[model samples]
Target: MDISTVEDALVTDAKAHLIQPWPTSGQIGAEARSGLMDGDGIYVTDMEGRRLIDGPAGMWCTNVGHRCEPIARTLYDQAMALSYSSPWYTMSEPSVRLSKRLAGHAPGDLEHVFYTTGGSSAVETALRFMQFSNNVTGRAEKKLIIARQGAYHGSTYLSASLNGRPRDHDWMDSASDLVVKLTCPNPFRRPSDMTEPEFCDFLIGELRDVIETRGAENIGAFVAEPIMASGGVIVPPQAYLKRMRALCQENDILFIADEVVTAFGRLGHVFASKEVFDIEPDIITFAKGVTSGYFPLGGAMISSKLLERLRSSNHSDAMFAHGLTYSSHPIGCAVALTNLDLLEQGLLAHAQEIAPYFQSQLKTLEDLPLVGEVRGLGLMACVECVADRKSNNPLALDLEVGKRIDAHCQRLGLLVRPLIHMCVMSPPLTITRPQIDDLVSILRQGIKLTMDELVREGLWRG
Candidate 1:
């Protein structure tokens, strides 16, 4: 069969049998989506033969770009040597070596690592550890987790409960009783009457109020992402994370930094908690870019101070009793080690140097009448669309504004991740200045096209 025929067959099969993530009720199992055939560096080619820039970097995970030779070779070599090992009885050398390397890069007292299959499991493991630690230390009642609005932790029960994004928990049941949520620190979405500093102060004050109302003794952990990635790249105000960390410290609550989207050179660092955000978290959960999306590997780095305290506690003999069968898979660890090498060899510095240019170029999109704001940090950014500049209301234009823009951008040689009224761009670190120019140019045209459509349809006037 020809390539087009094969692509059609694949799509038919998927529509018949596959149920994708976040499927709507109208097309839960029968959704027909785009068919991507191949990827190289910062671009992917669809089955239709259109080469498009990978704006979301494969769900913000492909840090070193697609088809990396070193990571590919490591996968093969490690599989040939030792493909898998049961974490229950045997531990692999790759796991041990990678753990040491990661520990060296992690900040402060985060000296130990617990491996998992992916981000959800990694976050689940961290929450379970927090619960286990409290149980063992005779503080079982302190099990309520603190999460913020617009945050995305994971899909597991405990972790999903911590997710505060819209529609995350609408159709699904969660451990709602075990979680306390705070306001999202998005400056753009803050009340019109408040200043940025005042908004920051309000967020901190709200957290303090929650702690006082619920009693800090009942709070087990405060989980957050330095910049809420899936929530439209919401970068909190300056000093926000540091202040939150201090509050967690004062209250004896564990601060969990979910860096699944930010770690491994996405933000020009191995870890962003200390180096970029100036905060040391008690537990750091990461997965996406650990192997640059080449292998399924995620882990939670634990604070040495917390571990030492647990070791000295009276219930030290109590077992945590949590382990995944593929926790330390040899192939995943080996690929991750090689991926780290690539990042350290200069990709990290490259991301740091090019980040300013990326942000500045994307910021130019705010000149469009439909664009309400252009905001992000590092290599990640979002172009939020609104009906009018004064009102800054995206709902007036409808949530599908992002989808319309994405459709236009895809036609113009780009793939954008549409999140309601926002289009997120987190291209691979290997993207050059020229590639960025192309991306921004295509995006501007796309938005302009979308604006024209809206105006013609009488949905918007600008």
Candidate 2:
């Protein structure tokens, strides 16, 4: 059959069986698919049947991969015992135990677990809770939230409003009133010659400027990822978050850490905040790795001080009055607990130790001419593409370089995320060394192929 016929057959097969996204075929393959496909144990199998090592574990969520008897057994037993329960009134053992376990790992007084269906909802909950707490404490004017310019918190209406992505504004217009976005701390594209200390000073100054202009009188909190994700894996210069926290304190603004992409063993610690830059945010949002992507679950770990103030209720306020029917889902919580046990047992350490290996693999990507910068810590990394590395001019908008590399990877049997012109690495933490090495090899090959294609297409010249 011709290529389009074969492609149509594949598409038809998917369409016949899958309910699809509005634009996408429902699955996340691109207008073009990334080159690599995942197979069992760090290898992804593509449509053509080639198996490639999955370097960044499935969107950086799979701390435990493929098949693990322990995790599966936990799911099975939990499902059999009781898969469904309303956490609002009656509760399940797994749900109760999961909350305590999460609290145990959380820092400072961030001890209460409020569940959600996923990360976006978790973020919305964190933001809403902060606003509610502020209102309860007689600070009704504190409603404005400070978000980072390029962070991806969530995609819900309010959550999307708070997103810092420029594309977000282009896609939806009515979201500006809810969030005030600050600049991202990327040392490359928006290079700041400032030392780590100076960088923090600069960002804090910017935030301070915002508070000054907008008046913290109307701001509720400032939320950011411990490490920026989706918008490009931008690891902050040291002391940025701490300084931000101090700034928030100075302005009486709540500091929130959006840990959706950095949580679990992705950064080698239980949470990214704990792994590096030990700043304690008043609210922390998490999802993705909580159950290693086995079950849908997300939550916020609210500090004791904040919850205490919010829960007191000046007479009657209706228990914060926000939640979904599946707020504290039983099966989701159960799976998360089992995942937590596995994490505590040893996966976290293994994931952390593999960072050096991941780093080593990533180091190879720097050789590509189009690559302007490569940055990451732990399993998550980003390789930014630019026309001029010196000027750090990103490949012209609409150049579609990230998707190109992703498509190449998919063709080669690998999958990856390309946010802007930066290709991110967030392979499953459970990936083996051999698998990681294979992924690196494929990445190198994919880069070479994509660069050659780009140069030929006149997008780049060497």
Residue-wise lDDT of candidate 2 within 29-84, one digit each (tens)? 33333223335756666556667556556666777875667777878887888878
lDDT of 1 by residue, 1-462 (tens): 788898999999999999998898999999878989999999999988899999999989999999888888888898899988899998999999999999999999898999999999999999999999999888999999999999999999999999998699988999999999999999999999999999999999999999999999899999999999998899999899999999999999999999999899888999999999999999999999998888889999999988987899998579999998889888999999998999999999999999999999999998899999999999999999988889888846556899999999999999999999999999999999999999999999999999999889888878
- Model 2 residue runs over 4 Å out of place are 1-10, 13-39, 191-197, 397-399
- My TM-score estimates for the predictions, one after another, are 0.99, 0.91
Native-vs-model 2 lDDT? Answer: 0.78
Error of 2 at 297 (Å): 0.3
**Which residue runs does candidate 1 get wrong by more than 4 Å?**
none
What root-mean-square deviation over C-alphas does model 2 reach? 3.3
**Full-model lDDT for every candidate:** 0.93, 0.78
